[model samples]
Target: MKYLGIDFGIKRVGLAVSDETGKMVFPLKTIHRSTRENLFLELLNIVEQKGIEAIVLGLPLRPDGEKSLTCRQAENFMHSLGRRTSLPIYTVNEAYTSLEAEEILSGKGIRGKKQKESLDQAAAMIILESFLECIPYERGLK
Candidate 1:
């Protein structure tokens, strides 16, 4: 099954997708959040275009695991997205994913504005990877 991973932000949203086998993940693209409706439409289009079967959404949490305002916003986004799509949606804690993404980018010699532009997509990849690690994959089905 193909999966879509999302790292939601107030200003920008990051996206990633898993291969048909669900063993390999790739950074898709970053969508600038100009408006909620526009973002949702674009996401829906990607889901249809990519044959995405499920969604893994990153839910921001405080370091201590408490829900913050951003977490609430993520939940709201999840709810809105759920209403729009019938596909299953799952949330995973996204603590430090951005920092991890930055480190990965820095290792690749990406910095400054370039790094900032790609950070969310990299983070989404991390979030999706974490989810893939937890799920049990069968031989014939992903």
Candidate 2:
């Protein structure tokens, strides 16, 4: 089952998609927040065009595993999003995905504005990669 991974923010949401085999993930794009309808419409287009089977979201929890304001906001977004689709929604802990993503970009010599543009999508890919590594294959989670 192919999956769409999301790193959702108020101003921007990062997107990633698993290959058809669900074994590899790649960064898709970042969507600037306009309205909820527009956001969902874009996602729906991706879902239809890409044959997405599920969605995995990043929950921006604190390093200590406590729920921060951002975490709460993510939680709310998840619940609100649940109403828009029947496909399962799963969340992974996204404590330092952004930092890791930045490091990845630096290692690859991607800098300045390019790094800023790709950061969120890279984070979504990291989140998806982590989830793919952790879950059992028989469950079709990856």
Candidate 3:
């Protein structure tokens, strides 16, 4: 099933999408936070337009795997998002995804403040990529 992966933040939400086969996840775009209604409506538009069958939210947990304040906030956001869309939503542990993204971009010489700004997209990609790796089909059914 096609899936939309979201890296949610208070200020901006990074988005990614999986192909129908769910083998690859591609960075879509980032959306600035808005009124609850507006955010949900916009996301719904993308879901419908893209034929998204499911949603995966990235949960920013602490390094030791503990839920932090941000985790609670993400839980609330996920609940609200599900309420608005009535679609199945899943979450993947997002510890260090941002840092990992930063390291990757830095390796490519994406430097300075610009690299920081790209973290959201990179984190979203990491989140989706991790989930992608777990799929049996994607990993040769191993």
Give the TM-scores of the predictions, in the order they appear.
0.94, 0.93, 0.89
User: Scored by Cα lDDT, where does model 3 land?
Assistant: 0.86
Q: Give per-residue CA lDDT, model 1, range 38-127, as digits (tens).
A: 999999999999999999999989989899998899999999999999999999999889999999999999999999999999999999
Q: Return the lDDT, model 1, position 50.
A: 99
In model 1, which runs have C-alpha deviations exceeding 4 angstroms?
A: 137-142
Pick out the ten consecutive residues of candidate 3 with the lowest summed lDDT: 130-139
Candidate 2 pairs with clashing backbones:
none
Please report, in order, the local distance difference test score of every candidate based on alpha carbons.
Answer: 0.96, 0.91, 0.86
Q: How many backbone clashes does candidate 3 have?
A: 0
Tens-place lDDT per residue, model 2, 20-83, is 8778999999999999889989998998899999999999888788998988988888888789
Top candidate when judged by lDDT against the true structure: 1
Q: Write the per-residue lDDT of candidate 3 for residues 1-142, one digit (tens) a residue.
A: 8889888888888888999998888888888887777778888999999999988889988878889988898899899887788778988999888789889999999989888677787888888888877878655888
Ranking of all candidate structures by their lDDT, best first:
1, 2, 3
Instruction: Give me the runs in candidate 2 sitting further than 4 Å from their true place.
Output: 137-142
- The total number of steric clashes, by the backbone 3 Å criterion, in model 1 comes to 0
- Quality of model 2 by C-alpha lDDT: 0.91
Which ten residues in a row are the worst by lDDT in model 2? Answer: 133-142
Error of 3 at 45 (Å): 1.1
